[model samples]
Target: MALTDTAIKKLKPSDKCTATRPDKYSDMNGLQLWVRYTGVKSWVVAYRYQGKQQNISLGLYPFISLADARNETTKIRNDLAQGINPKDERQKAKQKDNLDFDHFAQIWFEHQQTRIKPHTFKRDKGVYYNHIKPLLGDKDIYTVRLPDIMAVHDRLALQGKTSTAHKVIADIGRIYDHAIIKGLAPNLANPIPRGIHKSLVEHKSKHYPRIKITELPKLLTDIDTSNSEPLTKFGFYVLCYTFVRTKELLGMTWQELDFDNCLWNIPANRMKNGLPHVVPLAPPVIEILQTIKSWHLHDEFVFFSNRGKDNVLSSNAFTVALKRMGYKDKMTGHGFRGLASTSLYEMQYNPQAIELQLSHVQGSKTVRAYNSANLLPARIKMVNDWANVVNEVKQGDFSTYKAKSTADGNEMAFISFLQSLRYKEQEIQDELDIHRMERLEVLAG
Candidate 1:
């Protein structure tokens, strides 16, 4: 007999515990509402495919209501009419859950290699092969639970590599996401749980080695006189002047420059933050670029290699040159970013202008979405001020620089700093007086 919700609720557990006749209500088309002796209710479907009978459960009881159960039965009857067996297809999906994680990770890496930056992919590849794959490669993706993930984190953390431990787990999470998106593991969740790193050692992000702003003069002297190739030599100088990331500097193309507007518009893909950045070119950088443009070596890349199959210079070009200039393990290409940001803030420029110029992703999502070229004029002014310092230091002059401690918003102290840079006392006084009256008139307005 067919089943109804009211009658199914009144049904009792089997006295013989389903050992006698089947304790189930057979509805129609081999579909039955099953009641175990322990009072567990379930909906089951029985069908024939290739002349063999098969059974599968739709779901468990009041959860799978009468109409829902009937709907599942109708679908199973339709599958039998089409000669398709649900049980065999179910086995195929279960087999996919047993897929080796290493095999799946390879597919994910291939997709990433063609999509992400070479350097970024290189880092992820190293982490996977060195740390993650060794631990999780032999296991099935579905079977990698929190304990297995914690093992990967603990192994690296034991070596005092907390930052790397954080990165590999993120990579593992991304790989699972790729699998799900590709329909390989459709019903599985990412094994790397979120916020799992909080309970263990707090990840202290590492910074590249840096030199103080006072060291710029000697570094500039070495860069100008280095025996490196001309593009690489001047590329280091321009890297200091612009302070863009090493990759962004190397990946610059001739078409990205706007000489008339004095701006360099970096495209979204090249930027680490995946947002387009506008670099205000100072007169000093423009002079360096004009000199590079005069080389007429490669029409495509601004910094092309005379020796590489890719036509552009290698990514490690700066590090190699820095080491050659006797700055190994002391100052890296990324150090210029930290140096410039600190020096600029010390110079009393607006902090927002400094951060946006650095291409840092900050503030809330909504604020970031609307802030594509925020603080343009302030950034232009700040970069010009910074470039003047670089240009002077490039010419072997260190007297023009002022540390933050010596000059912090004091007119007299600034005047004394200018005097120390060899400005005549009277000239400094006149300049300050002119600006002071201008400020007064502006305040009156």
Candidate 2:
């Protein structure tokens, strides 16, 4: 017979000189109220799975009442019928409790070390140590939800470390993804969901702040007149005219240059995107290259370090030059690319040609290869046109350039050519070129 609430309430422990042994009273569906002779009461379920008897604890007396205990017992009997052992399931859950976020993050970092570049590995390690491990490290990864991760992200953003916050979310997501693949946290959702940046306030997203086109002439003049070393000045000009990345500009070898073809072919290993990049040498760029070659005579790299011949220039060399030129916050070595890109677009140059000259990935691998080949002639013309603009900046400011909006319908040509190149209407309108339509009208007039 099933025990009643009144019977359980009236029951009392039998006093003894030693600790009292537990007494079991069975109810329907493998449920039992186990009472100690000392008066303590608890609930348990006894069942047989695969021909063996097993017991799983539910909880204490009043907390897990007779009804609740019976409900749990029915669930266990259902498990037994399905050949599932609740004891083993509980053990698995306990194992997951030991798998915390920090433990898994360290494992993920160790595995990634062998796959990525040494510099990249070092940078990622800094991100983990500085941002991620402090807050979520000891927490169980399975228990970490979106709000918990978002709290850390928001804190970093509030401190104006927006890029760091973005990186933290990405790194945490990668760690969780690795955990799932390794069967560590299979059921836990990634706290940092995809496209979460859409929800975060968009920081201006300037990797390097560049000056406006109209401001370029003064900057160029300062660079030319600055008492910095000739080699530094030459490197600055090469960076400006080539518009290559700082690392690409610093790590150049004479062997990579084909003066006859007026090109510099950056090998795949040296390139960030792991594809060979070709930089066209305009006349002025070639002059600066020749000057740099003369200074380096037998040196392997064009820009050798001041400390030693074998070592290339320090990465901070360009930054130092920018500071000397009073362009520390106004511009950067990377900013040259933005300056070149903006000016080229506003000049109504072909977008594909400009993109090719910049070595930006245009499309699929086969498409990129085809575009690289087909885009060369157009790139040569585009680079020369860009060089001419830089030369004009070196010459003087634009006080003489006049305004005429229609330019005999040449403004329509801007819309047509940019549209043919597949630029969206809004994107075209947003370009600095469109904004400079008034200035361009003055120049054309």
Best by lDDT: 1
Best prediction by TM-score = 2
lDDT of each candidate versus the true structure: 0.75, 0.74
Backbone clash numbers for all candidates listed: 0, 5
Give the Cα error of residue 39 in candidate 2, in Å: 68
Residue-level lDDT of model 1, residues 196-291, one tens digit each, is: 666776665445777666567789788878887888877777778888888888888999999999999999878888888999999878998999
For model 2, what is the alpha-carbon lDDT of residue 127? Answer: 74
C-alpha TM-score for every candidate: 0.60, 0.65
lDDT of 2 by residue, 353-417 (tens): 77777777767999999989888888887787677777775675443222112233244545654
Worst 10 residues of 1 by lDDT: 400-409
C-alpha-based local distance difference test score of model 2: 0.74
The regions of model 1 sitting more than 4 angstroms off are 1-134, 137-145, 158-161, 171-194, 364-366, 369-374, 394-400, 403-445
Model 2 compared with the native: what TM-score?
0.65
